[model samples]
Target chain A: MLRINDLHASTQGKNILKGINLEIKPGEVHAIMGPNGSGKSTLSQVLAGNDAYEVQSGTVTYKDQDLLELAADERALEGIFLAFQYPVEIPGFSNEKFLRTAVNAQRRHRGEAALDAFDFSAMAKDKMALMELDPDLMSRSLNVGFSGGEKKRNECFQMAMLEPSLAILDETDSGLDIDALRIVSQGVNALRREDRSVLLITHYQRLLDYIVPDYVHVLANGRIVRSGGKELAVELEKTGYGWLEDEAKSGEVAR
Target chain B: MKTATPDKSLTYRDVFASGQAEEKSWARYAAKRESALAAVLDRGLETRGLEEWVHGKAAGLVAGDALPVRGEVAAAGSPEMARVAGSHLLVFVNGVFDPARSEIGTLPAGASVQPLSAGDEAADLGSVARDVESSFTALNSLFWRDGLQLILADGVVLEQPVELWFVNDLAGEAGLIPVRNLIQVGAGSEATIIERFVLGQAAVVEQPLTEVVCAAGSVVNHIKLVGGEAAGEHFGSTHVVQRADSTYRSWEIVTGGHLARRELHLDLTESGAKCDLNALYMGAGKQRFDLRTRVNHDAAECETRELYKGILDGEARGVFDGLILVARDSQQTSAHQTNRNLLLSDDAVANSIPRLEIYADDVKCSHGSTTGQLEDEALFYLRTRGFSPEEARTYLAWAFASEVIESIPVLELRAELSAVVTRTLDVVDDTLMGELS
Candidate 1:
């Protein structure tokens, strides 16, 4: 359902993602793990069409459509969701209002009638339960004074509300505690469907343990160096990316 | 005959001469404003200057000789207007007192509505209005023909808010109109006062004065809603005094004004008095809005809180100056002031100045101001959640205003003001595309 070919992107004239090529079918979950400055987050941002990053070369297709040509909001309406690493705190905007607007926007994009206030409220109530978020939190300003774990859960709550075709979570487990991690992962696992795809971006192997992926890709120095089954994450966690760096060097020497 | 753009000092003089009989009685205070204008002219409109004239100028207000008195008022208001309880309802047309348009229902038991023009029976209470007179107040006192005087007997509670409607429907060119209001709440009496200003005529500029007084141990809730012809220009002032244990809360919402400047002064004279002042301004299409306010904590254990927020787009300009003064003997006083603005265009400008003058050693006073554009990260977050860029911006802007809008007591008025703000921001329309976008 998603394809990236020779994707090269940069931000502020500094190259970040270089020659990235990947493909995944529906019902598949792929995990991208990398060290600091390895372009893992950059790939997620580029895929979500963050305007800050400029695509120098390459094309991305989602469900047979040119994803690169779409605007950030258009990509979202087309069922591409990116759970930001640092979710923004939008003061004065209630979570219920935000979620309703988002859900309706996606519905409208899919040629369906937008949900009324009552319908949206019912849907949000059900989804809030799924994410274990308090009703009071949904009534307050969006993430204005939310705790780190609350922010992660709110993001997942939104993911559940929008029901995106491709969900790319960028470091969703960074600041979460063990309990929050379990809850967030449970929400993600519950939302998994055969017609949808998930891309998990992380720096550790802990999140992968909760939401096991079909494949694991090691991203180092702007390129995917290795791809294997979910066990590759546990192996990398044991040996670290230093071995992958050596393999990259040896491969370069051979070239 | 049309005159050259008059100087700020001379402008006050013109307004004073053209004021009504009540306003003329306080004309002697013009010297103080004249001196202030001279200081501003000599030192210039600096950010540090707390002068009202300087702040008015920052709002792009050009004082005219007189306000055009179109003499038009709504013949009949909606049922809600009748439902609102008040000791008296004094309506004005083009700043002229219109007795015919007012409806003074059955006064609360032991309450009276004494017309200021009808030989002041309670002349002693008039001293507060006369003693604390500024140039604008003096002008309003001189011009106002008839004003509402509410007297609540000790321990009376009035549930309905007293409504004062000021209509500016000047079709022709008149300038610098002044209006006055004197409210007296008896000891341990409670009441609510709402003032509505509607500009019906379009003109090059408008300068009007407004004065108010809250008596001892009385509670007053003042809501000022401004909506007028798109080209309306307005300059007004409200002065409030809270005696021992009295509470005063004023909410000012300005949606459409070519150049609107309002000055609010809260004097906490007696111990245990409190004031809560909140304001919201929505400007677009070259509109300029300025608000200058001062909260004086003179007695011990007084509290003052203020929150002013603005949303400016197009080439609009917003200026807000809030000052908190804790007097030398005002110990244990608590004062807080905050002003925040959002600019939607690069050309839009917002100047927020929060000033605190604390003389007491044992006081907690804090002030903060912030001016910024739409948060890019928030915008991106909303977009990724499927909201169009325009819809996201509008939602955020409205959300920012909801903080202030919710404070208005009148639900219908608040909803209308919110709609006006949405229309002014061009964020929404009746069309489905507008909603979707």
Candidate 2:
């Protein structure tokens, strides 16, 4: 339900993602594994309509509409969610209020009724339980003084409440312990549906062990050099991305 | 030391001379007024400058054709009322006590709220905050027509808060309004006092002084809200004296006048006394809000915590000057001060100066200040969460401000204040404007 054709993007006059082509169909989990500086996170930010990344060329199509034409907030209302690698700390804005606002904004965009406080608390309790989060997290300021794992879990909690059609998880496991990883992965897996798709971007194959992907693509030097079903992750995991980096360098030398 | 001197000194001397003929209750303070005028003259009128007044000039006498504020009530002018249940409200108009509009309900035992005229101000008024404290305090002592005197008997625990509403409505005329209040929380007594200054229709220069005395073992909460649509300036000062084992907390929210200046001086006079001051100042439309606070720990084991925040938009200016002084021999004193500001427009100005003077060897003291716009990453994060850009900015700005008022006990007042900050950042509900408009 999403397509990126030769998507070239840059930020601060530095080209990061060059000629990236990817397509995710409904109900599919596509894991894009790449080493550092391979432009995986940049790709996710560009897709989520981060204006900081200038789309130099190419186009992105989401559910048959021009995705780049939408602003960041519009993309969010249109069911595009990007779990930030570093969740921001909004010191005095309660997590509950932020969640309710996000939920109501989406509902309003779809012509649905906004949930009142009573209704919202009930929904939040269930989501909080599903993510194994502390009940007090709802009232506390968003991500302020939260442990790294708690911040990642909060991102997952928001993902569950937003129920986005395109979920882009960008290095969400970078700072999580094993237990937090399981809970976050379980939260993501529980929300998978026939009409929803996920673009899981990570540097390591450890997260794939929890939520196995339908397709694994090895990315190097801003390009997807190889794509295969699941096993590509295990192979790359056992040997590391060193061979891929060498091959990229050799390929550049040949050019 | 450059200090602000009043403008139009001749006008003030002439007004004081003409007032000598009136046989008023306060006519007894003729000598005090004369000395206060001398103090005003001692500063030299042309000085008109102070480092503290660089950003916010102490509003001077500019009331063209200023009228005599002779405790007169003209039709009982109305202003927005913040009705918190179990509150004793004293509404004043043009420096006159409005008995018809006030609700000085049957106060609890050992509690009394009286007009300053009814009390003996000769010996009690300047006992806590002397006129020489500042030029504004001197001016207030010189011209204050009427005020409120609140006293809680020793060991009296007041169950209700006292609300002081000072409304200045000049009927579209230029004038000067002065308000002086004295609060005495008896030893071991506890009380909460909320004060608001509202202005309407005409150019006005407001000089206000509030002196608070917290006796030993007493606790006092002083929440003052200063703002009005008056088209001129505001100069006010608050002096708090805390005795042994007493606690004094001050909450100041200022958002009014063309240029409003507030100076708060706190003295922890005895061992184990504690003081906490929190302020939120918002400005817009070329308006200026100046807040200066000095906390003096005069005894051993005293503690002080202070936090002030500012939000400025348009070409408005906000200045925060906070100083914590741990006097010599005041060992074991701990003090902390923080000031943060947010500028919304390029032209908006914020000046933050935090100072700490520690003379004792065994004291802990620190001060910090920061001024910046909203974080870009924070703005982007909010937008990516489905909030419109404007909504994102408002929510961020509100969070930045509501932190200062988080300690207010009443939820409804907090909510109203949050809405006020969200709407104008000035914390004034324009819709709540009273019939005085």
Query: How many steric clashes between backbone atoms does each model show?
Result: 17, 0
Which number leads on TM-score? Answer: 2
TM-score of chain B of each: 0.80, 0.90
lDDT assessment of candidate 1 = 0.74
The list of candidate 2 runs beyond 4 A from truth reads: A252-255, B1-14, B17-23, B28-31, B44-51, B61-68, B71-75, B425-437
Native contacts recovered, in order, as a fraction for each? 0.76, 0.68
> Using alpha carbons, what is the TM-score of model 2?
0.92
lDDT of 2 by residue, B149-178 (tens): 898989998878888888777654446677
lDDT tens per residue, model 2, A1-255: 899888888999999877788889999999999899999989988988787889999989999999999999999999989999999999778898788888888898999988877999999899999999999988888999899999999999999999999999999999889999999999999989989999999998999999889999878887777788899999998899988878766764111
DockQ of each candidate's interface versus the true one? 0.52, 0.51
